[model samples]
Target chain A: MNRDFAIECERLSRIYRSGSIPGRGRETPALTDLTMQVPKAVVFGLLGPNGAGKTTTIRILSTLLAPTSGSARVLGYDVVKQAKQVRERIGFILGGDRGLYGRLTGKQNVRYFGALNRLNPKTAKRRGDELLERVGLAAAADTLVEEYSRGMKQRLHIARGLLTDPEVIFMDEPTIGLDPMGAQELRQYIPELVGQGKTILLTTHYMLEADMLCDEIALIDHGRLVALGTPDEIKRNFSRLTIFEIVVNQTSETLTAELSNIDGVQHVETSAEGIFQKITIAVEAGVDARDQIQATIGAERVESLVVRDPTLEEAYVSILT
Target chain B: MAAALHNIALQAYYSYKGLFLWLNWTAYISNVFIAPVVFVVIVTLTGRFAGQSDSANAYIIGMAAYAIPAILSGGILQSFCYERTFGTLSLIYASRSNRWVTYWSKGLLHYPNGLLAAATSLLFGWLLLDLDFSRLNWPALVVLLLVISFSCLCLCLFVGNFSIALREWIIPVGITNGLLLITSGVVVPVDQLPGFLGEIGRVVPLTHGLSALREAFEGASLGDLVDDIVYELVVGLCYLLAGGFLFSLLEANAKRTGTYESAI
Candidate 1:
């Protein structure tokens, strides 16, 4: 119940019962007893593998779904009991093109959603125009949504979600189908939305997108919170090892054994790429075991060697695996 | 308050104009404009083929009255059905707009559309059926058309409650249409219909309303037919209220089940 937190959930959980059979069916749990909070005026990213409950959490907080157990509050209003208040203060840009009215013109679609949020006609018109322009859809405002491409439809979804000028915006894969330029522009717009004193909770599969946009990222797996921290903190804390990627003509157990036996070598993984066998070695933070490993492999078998810091994507994979 | 009214107007207009596939010019022309005329033709031609050309006027009157269910019911049903298909119903449910206002206003445009189609059928009846226009009480018949059209709209609103919850409109709409055909005295007399159908005919829209319509066409006064018109109106309102109640109940259930993201 912290007032500073824009979004708060206490052991929020949801189970979907499949009523496929007459009296009995399997139950699927989309979210566990997950408690999390996002502060105001920042981009909070939820990163997870598929079916990790990111969308379910968004749906609950946005007042689109109710928790089977526990509770969630957005902007200090209960998502279930005070849904009207919550819906009035929040907006959501859910992924996929199916949510929009395909037969309506872009402007009409905006106007329709504005009306649903009870936006006054004149204000809706002005704000709809502003949002459509901001989303790069002003020119196509008069065009039927069915005629628009997948990217254009997505942009319209953004415009519709912003029509109410919500305090907390939940975006589920906002840039999923956008072109590179559109995606880049949308990413740039995220912080600008935050700058307007709005809290944004977004879910995306792009590690770089989360790294670049999220002030704090929460990674969930199998309906549970797995990791939560700033991008740099996660990358640094989760993995304090420099990685060495070595290419060889081929690798044998002897080479792997020798590399693993080297002092300060933390972990070694092998995979084949193209015609060459690649050996990825994780080394301890303060240990320079590179010369010993390369010497053990010998110069004749060593095709190439590259050293680099761990990326957010690499850290994410390490923690998840 | 004004904004809420605006929401209703916008939702009603956009639902009929954008959400329904009948907005497409070709579909509109073929389905809305052409279909009613075809229905009238089939009934009149059937009467002629049965060597009962004298019964053509009654058949045309019965058939013309049918535009209420055919036009208004379908129109109102689509307001609920297409919203689910487009995944916008869930969006509306998640919003702060008044659900009662949104639900009832869905048939605003459709009621008038049904009346227009009914009038057109009447005009076609006068032109094609060699019917007597002199016997028709224009004022009383106008009231009858309006009442029956609204009643049918309400009936569809009732059916729409399930059209959305079940995520299948075709079956419900088709069954409703078939029931009206057999039980609403569109082509058969209500009393002449078999036992259960006769009872059903009394409860549905056109049976009572159409009886009054035929009387009004024969120059019966509106005051005398008030009982029948009232019965029709009461039946319609009952359906509408039931629909509204069921809609609220389903919404709560959907929230609990978490199926509002799409129709279940």
Candidate 2:
């Protein structure tokens, strides 16, 4: 394992076998020979759709689950062989509101987990107080966890995950069930943790969140790594087609066909809203279709036109599809 | 080593904290005292109707022994089941602290609760019934309670292993409670049971422990009950070892199967 990489997995494969009775099950592979490395102190995002093995990868790296055949090392410690050492240096928060004790206060939950990580009593208490404050949960520290809102509970989860002051943190869909403002608030803490030299492996299905937070991203599909790069690099490399969105007072098959026939235009799709027709055209790289698009649709019928680079979502869709 | 000890202590603290802090006093009293007292009264009354005073005294002692499993099986079931249901089992498993140590800490914390319930039942039996306590061997009774509590905890651990593996605690705990009640010589003497079941009862820790308690109540010393005490200890240790092995196996299987990620 390289010391510079916070996490390194070599051909990791996890196959789950299922059957009602023992020795009579079919095997389903969740991860297939997936090899990747995450550099230290980077906010690494594992972006994928649901059931894309992102959580499986996080679980294996964090020592909650063992890979079926391959090896994974976190911070120079083998996840399987040196699992306790790996656990000592790492922490994780899974998505949802079920991890905390409903009967215990928010502070009590943090302190209990701190103790589980073997922190001394005084240190655990101090760290719990600091983390609760940092996560905007100090005000609700003494409230029973069951009474806290989903966002408050999620913040408490974050505080508990950080109680150990781990060098590497794993967050699996941390903002999965939060409101827009809650998600925005949680996003602000990622950079702070990364700023403190902690390597964060975050898994999310939200392409926009990944784009905003990740320094490096790995796009996974069907248990395989499809693309890996910085957000801008991925947008530039995977997407070679620019998008043109046009709003017209009226549109029909003739206009769409005419736009499709324009030079360098690969495909033209049209949809009719209540009072306006919208046209999205994909054009080849280095080709400008502004003049042709305007001429084909007629300048008088056009209400608005916009030309821009493909977004990360468009890039993700293009690569996956 | 110190950290491990600290972890255990903290686990116990948190486990007990939840119980004491959240559970209402009325609920706690009803659960710990009412059920055991009612059961002892019913058994002693039935024995008295049969005009078997000796059997009545035996029934009272057996009912006191029954409290160990009554409190422990539920406590153990909750300890394992609640974690999975609450989604904290994976977090606990991922921590640096040893899983076995954490589980044992919870078990050890519940031990005193089980003893308290057992004592309540015994005290009620003495007060409600005209049972003779003047000849009771105090040290021998203490030893018997200790042995019975440890043995029941081991049995609970064994049941807890299966509960995690199956991802269902209610059924396993229920079956265990039924089997122990019918076969552990609590309401019926082991010698009077059917041949195979009586043999099974002899192997159960409660049978030996209850027999030892009866001997102590009848003025037998620790030396007189050495054989039964030894048997109880041996059985308790075996259950503990087997439970530990099963817990490891199920945990490894859960990891390999990805069941840890699934909700119970």
Candidate 3:
């Protein structure tokens, strides 16, 4: 009910019942008592692994799926009761290449979607051209989508999602299959759209993508919200343990056991990479076990040593574990 | 109202582009234009070989009526199936525009195409088979064509709804097409059909529409063929209402079941 929020949900839940015979199948909960709010004109990221209910949440908010219980509102309109209003103000780009007509050209696909949003033919065509150019696909606008590469198709998906000039856009892993350069270029457009005062709800498994693009991040697991804050705030709050990483020419079980016995060292993990061994030690705050670890492992065998703050991925792992 | 119309126009434009503009003209000609003409030719040749002029005439009219479902129903059903497979159905559902407008607009592509197919069949019959039109009641024929088109459109809508509602649409669509071909009195008179099939034939709009068309071709006035025309109109309306109701129920079920996201 907050007018200042672009999206608001209260106890939104979706329970999918399987099997054709009612009451004869198992019930799967895709979302559970989820409550969150996203303020207007900010980039919000829902960071989670696969099957973590991120896509389900996006589908519910986009008005494509109705919640089994509770409610969600987009721009002050109920996603279920006033789906038309919500849909009018929002656009969605789902992951993968399935949504497009492979037979149609990129420009034609954009124009078709624009028309579906009720743009006149001329306006749809003009806007479609503009969007194609904006997405760096103007040169290949006339080519069939089937002929385009995965990266080009992903870019076209972005252009189609923007055809309506929506006030809010839901991008569900838009860069899932893109190359490194392709993903970087696509990421650049997110802030540009936000600069124009549009709210974006992005879902991604890439922690770095979320850290780079999202102004606010909410991490969910098993259909439940686990952590919510800005990137730095999350790293600061959830990351209480210090970490020391050491690369050695060879590591034996004796060396790992010795490091484990060191006072204040909570956990030690090691993995073999080629001829070298990488070891990571998690220790309690205020503990300086670096010198002891170096002495136990023998400084001559140490290939490299570094101590650093926990990254977002490490923070996420810590929270989840 | 303006927005709805715009949506319709744009959807139709895109459907035509996808269906025709993207494909080779030769493919289009072979698929849409030539197939109907070939069917007419085969039927005429068979009828001529049997020395049954009256049967040949009936065959021509029946085949023309058959083209209605063949093109319109098939087109609409294929569009629905492809939308699911192509993953555009969810996108369309997510759009703010009215879903009914989008559905109907995609279907509009079939009308012109069906008309063209039917007309070509009739023209071929006239040129090659020397079919007599001297007794044709022009006004009645026009009315019959309109009624047939409306009835086919209703059937297409019904099939479209059924496709979305059913988890597996292929078997159901195949069965429905098979039933239409078998019981719609396309190849033979409903009266000549054995047992309960004749009774079921009486219920399909194609049966009524084809009956009225044959009557009009035989010089009957619209008033003279009142029963068939009335039956066609009633059947078409029934289909339209039933399809709309079923679509709502199935759509709600899909949301609850979470089947809407999958291509299935």
**Each candidate: chain B TM-score:** 0.94, 0.93, 0.88
lDDT by residue for model 2 over B39-141, one digit each (tens)? 8889899998988876878888888889888878877777776777778878877887766677667677778867888898899998998667889999999
Q: Candidate 3 has which clashing residue pairs, if any?
A: none
lDDT of 3 by residue, A1-321 (tens): 888999998998988777778678888998898999999999999987777889889989988788999899999999999988898899887678789888888988997888778877677888889989987899999999999998888889888998888999999889977889879988998899999999999998888888899989888888888888888877777656678989999777688889999999878989986789999998776888889999999999999998876778777777777
Q: State TM-scores per candidate.
A: 0.91, 0.91, 0.89
Q: What is the lDDT of candidate 2?
A: 0.83
Per-residue lDDT for A240 in model 1? 65
- Candidate 1 structure quality by residue, lDDT tens digits, B1-264: 787677789978877777666766787666665778778878988989999888787777888888768877666777788788888877888788878777887888888777777777888788876766787788889999999988888888888888887777778878998899899888888889999999998888788898899888788899989999999999989888988888888788778877755721
Q: How does chain A of every candidate compare to the true chain A by TM-score?
A: 0.85, 0.88, 0.88
In order, candidate lDDTs are: 0.85, 0.83, 0.80
> What are the per-residue Cα lDDT tens digits for candidate 1 across A120-140?
888999999999999999999
Cα deviation of A184, candidate 1, in Å: 1.1
Q: Which of 1 and 3 is the better model by TM-score?
A: 1
Q: Model 2, residue A22: what's the lDDT?
A: 73
Best by lDDT: 1
Candidate 1 vs candidate 2: which has greater DockQ? Answer: 1
TM-score of decoy 1: 0.91
Candidate 3 C-alpha lDDT tens digits along B21-94: 31468755775678888887887688778887768878887787777676676667666666666777777777
Cα-based lDDT at residue B229, candidate 1: 93
Clashing pairs in 2: none
